[model samples]
Target: PPDDWREACLSNDLPEAGTLAVTLDEQVFCLYRVEGATYATADRCSHGRGSLSEGILEAHTIECPFHQGCFDIRTGAPTALPCNRPVKTYATREADGVVWLNTSPRDVAGQP
Candidate 1:
C-alpha cells in the first residue's frame, strides 16, 4: 500500500511560501508550499542537474540555481531560459497543517 503521504510532514513544520526537500521511497522531490496548497517536483534542474531545492520561488515558479532556469510549481514546465527540458512533478495537497504527496509511478512524469 502507498503511504498516506501527509505523514512526511510533522505538525507546524511547513513554512509559507517556502520550499521543503523530501524523500519518498528513495525518490527525492522539492516540496513547495505556495499560497496554502503543497506542490511537488523534482529537486534537480533540467539544466546541468542543479539542485532546485535551493532555487528561488516566484509566484508559482522556481528559478534554477545553475542557470537561472524557471519552472512552474504545478506542472514543472520550463518557464525561463537556460533550460527547456521538463521535470517530473508529483500530485500534492495539504491537510491539517501537513502536506501530502502522491508518489505513484508516472508514465512520462510532469507531462499533462
Candidate 2:
C-alpha cells in the first residue's frame, strides 16, 4: 500500500484471467488479472445485486451472476444488457508482488 491506496491482494493470488473478491472498509470490490494486467471494480453489478466475483470472466468482461449482464472489468462499462448502468471503477497497481487499489475517485484512472 502507498499513500491513499490500500492493499487488496497478492499479484500471484489472482490466477491468469481470474477474478477475486475483496472488501475494504465495508466496500466490496473485484480484482481481475487479464493479459498480464490487473483491474479493479465494484463487486456488485450495477443493474442488479449480482456478485461480480462469482460471475464469469470472458476476455475483459465480467458476466453478472444474477442477470447474466456483462461489464468491462477495466472501465466498468456495461457491455451487455440488462445492465445499462456502469459499476464504479478503481485504479490498480502491482507493487512488491501485491495488488494495490486507489479507491478514491480522484485517484482512479478508469472511467465509470
lDDT of 2 by residue, 12-99 (tens): 8999889999998789999999998988888989987889999999899999999899998877889999999888888888988999
Q: What is the C-alpha local distance difference test score of each model? A: 0.76, 0.86
lDDT of 1 by residue, 3-91 (tens): 64545564256677888788877877888877767778888887887888898988798998888989987777898998888778877
Instruction: Itemize residue pairs with steric clashes in candidate 1.
Output: none
Error of 2 at 83 (Å): 0.1
TM-score of each: 0.83, 0.90
Q: What lDDT score goes with residue 49 in model 2?
A: 84
Candidate 1 regions exceeding 4 Å error are 1-6, 105-112
RMSD of 2: 2.4
